[model samples]
Target: MRFFSQRRRPFLSVVICIHDMAREAPRTILSACCPYQKNVSPEDYEVIVVDNGSAVPFALRDGAGLSPAPRIVSMPHPRPSPVFALNWAARHVARGNHILFAIDGARIFSDQLIANTLRAHSICTDAFVYTLGCHLGPSVQMVSTTQGYNEDVEDRLIAESGWPAKPSALYNISVFAGSSSNGFWKPIVESNAFSVPRQLLDKMGGFHESFASSGGGLANLEIFARYVQRPDAKNVCLLSDMTFHQVHGGVATSAKVQHSTFAQEYFSIFQREYRFPSFDAIYLGPLRPEAAKFARIGLAE
Candidate 1:
């Protein structure tokens, strides 16, 4: 998603879109807003929660802990396409030099996720940066973990611990594999969360709102493909940071339920597979001790 014109600010605005995630909303919002340390000043980053036509009307009350808190926006009607809500938010309310899109509303993030991303962006301003995706289950494996995803299991575990999400907990559960030459950080199939200069996304005409599919997978892939394919754009993957997905019967990631029909439809329309970035990621390696310490603060007990 993009904002038109040439307005630049020093800070970042994160837009998170949710359809119906009342239970997972609190944890997700808080996790993003409650980072322990910021590479940039707290005021440099803002979070925007877009309740895209959820039946329960997701609230921004959990954001009270932030210095400025997060702003809440809503879609006028329920739409199968998350793209509609995303474009709506980007058009009306985003205020940042760069905009980061987090499509899933039900995610608990590492404390270092935002700070680390900001650090990368500050260093490589022209680059497109994205977080390493993780799913919440027995471990913090990649989003496409073979164990699959189970919302019930995640809910029960979090409820028993009574902790929202903490650095230590995230560390304990994180899993890694060597898909690349180095160990640890592997190549990601898709990035659910990514950051880009507002102008760049705008130049691409924002998100294509034609996707009326269950989860807007085609829209996401199309937007990301353009970003990756840009020859001058550096693609940086924040290795230390990860976004832990909380299952909400996701149209794309729900392992138990297959989206073959949706996939076929998407293929027929595009005449190709959802293009994964062909380039290897710019990996800066593992989390530092100080960053890990800072991350611990985001967790709730």
Candidate 2:
């Protein structure tokens, strides 16, 4: 069932950076490396989790349910530099021709995310891909949750009888599309779930290392602004998937706008040099089961 029966590189390398997400790391890792994920096999993708100096470092057991278990890296110092953490992990990747970067380690992904993205990437070499990023928490409860999405509420819903918690199925994905620079369906400027070719990632110089903002360098946003509009890049927005964030005391997501001094500083710097992509994505239709390319893995289109 492994994708790499031979010696070829994996289809993708999932790189996740963590600062202090002890509560959410396990869920994030499990979701990404779950044996049940049909989109891509354990052999087809490499999962790397970098713990950037948390009080309690991430520990993995010998036989975690995750096959080809996740590779764990612990940093010595605690710096609010997810940008650096990501590049550090990227440098350590030994396989996988493509890179799947998760800006936040708290995100629990849908099982089909990999399969759907792989299909899109495999078919279109020039398109820039983005899976919808959904904030999980009460709508308007935090700066991050523009809408009601309480994780506890979601958990309660899932725990109920006949709940829709199947990991292999395609999950609800919000589509927001609009025209920009004569292009339709622009990717959200701050999406946390996105995949890019290793070569293209290198071409973009990875995440910008200069920002060093208190809260994640906001380098994730900066990178998207520059590349999606590149004269040569192809922007492709996936309408049937999502990366659900786990509610935590996130720096930007939890902090009040007036209290977000670091974010303000970073934004000032960002605006001085970059113009954000006009729109996140072209608003399409509501969620439907037709979005999933693979029913489970081999069920076929």
Candidate 3:
């Protein structure tokens, strides 16, 4: 079902990819939309959610309260990897000059995410912007889940954090993921939320469809490495912004999977497909008091 907003061409387009996240997608969408995100109007950006063959198709009611509702596209026969679905939206549906990929739909954005992204682009039109990745728990979900953390525990943590009413409070409950363990001062392997110019994305042919592993198996890392390697690209990391991941039995974050075994298989595929590169980013945005503590943690590392 199509629910295109009549807004003008937005400066940014966000393509969120999800597969069987019926329980978590609503909060994720809400966090990226109006009232929750600060200092940005709906006209400034558009969100396109690509449902990658969920058992239960995504419905309009999942994003009911969102103003200028997201464009929901379903891929009934989606490949195991989300690379194809994400690429299809960027190539056909996205109208913004710049496109942001939320490779995991369960991740929620910080309040100033959109405003900070626009500011970074304005600073350098060729900027490749990303935020520090975080998990919505006392520690990374992969570890915390082993300690009995689940969606019910995560929901309680969110309520205690005072989100929406006080969105910055998200920092109180989150920890840097293993990919982002080095913190803001250092480079992370990949970003759950990252953006680039439409032209550049097209030039790179969007995500590499060759990454056919379940949940795109290191596909996000591949794209980030490729984009940052461009001599013309400016890597900007948002110090005050982040994407908080919600636990929903994801391939990498769930206790249901054998983490080491899954990592070994995916890394082997990644190694065969592309060369992994270390990334160092230019930190941007103010170090707000709420986020200052996390910055210190990264620096301490």
Candidate 4:
């Protein structure tokens, strides 16, 4: 009745970061996920959920019936940022060389989620691997709720993307149109998935500790551009396999705005301190990576 295959114990660490989750939301997530964990045999993996400062009611403990009994890593920051929460939780926990960050609000659609991601990483030429991130429809409340199977459900944006039907299925997608969003991945923290060498966390001196709360401005993107976006980076590949990320529009908009402003201001500070040419040069490189084959010519500028 456990999730995962009983015969095989895969090496993986599943990290879920939670903040300001409503009373029912956390239970809802666990309820839906528990069955899948049982069906999939969760013996091989470790699940760690980090509780960031939350304004609303929170369990402060794992809800009853939370199968696999995920470890509760507490971040008592009265007002901690999501980036900080994730970094704290991931810093010393999870045993596998592969680390996955699943948003607390996102439901695990298939038990095969972890299995497929690892399979992709095994074959990837790079050391780090990225799964095609997709949003699960709001109606699905648990992993068992996941129905139907479609490999091409999502369009492939990266050449490495593919459709595989195995222990699970994930629509190959970039959460924000292939742009990075806080979601799942292995060998990298959820907040720093786009970075190469995975160890960039220590190299960058860990998440910008300056920000009081969420929105560590351009910190995430800066790492991505410098580490993962480079053409020569190796051992990293985005999984085209279908994994479902539940979408409930659950993130706190008020909190999100506060962090956005903070992120923007903090990023500007980096620009000023570094004398960078343009904020876009430092922040939104997606718009214009100089080496991009599709760069705009003079008139388009």
Q: List per-candidate RMSD values in Å.
A: 6.0, 7.4, 3.6, 11.9
Off by over 4 Å in 2: 1-8, 61-63, 76-78, 140-158, 161-165, 168-187, 256-264, 267-274, 279-287, 290-301
Candidate 1's C-alpha runs over 4 A off are 5-10, 35-40, 139-152, 159-165, 174-186, 255-257, 289-301
Runs off by more than 4 Å, candidate 3: 1-8, 62-65, 255-276
Candidate 3 structure quality by residue, lDDT tens digits, 88-131: 77777788889899999999999889889999998988889998
Name the lDDT value of residue 114 in candidate 4: 48
| The candidate that achieves the highest TM-score relative to the unseen native structure | 3
- The prediction achieving the highest lDDT against the true structure is 3
Give the residue spans of candidate 4 off by over 4 A: 1-10, 23-41, 60-67, 107-111, 124-126, 135-206, 211-223, 235-263, 272-301
Task: Give the local distance difference test score of model 1.
Answer: 0.67
lDDT of 2 by residue, 19-124 (tens): 6776677778877775645647677788888887776777754335786588888754557777777777676543677778897888777666777677777877
Sort the candidates on lDDT, descending order: 3, 1, 2, 4
Winner on lDDT between 1 and 3 is 3
Clashes of each: 2, 13, 0, 25
Candidate 3 overall lDDT versus native: 0.81
Residue 163 in model 1: shift from native, Å? 4.2
TM-score of each: 0.81, 0.76, 0.90, 0.54
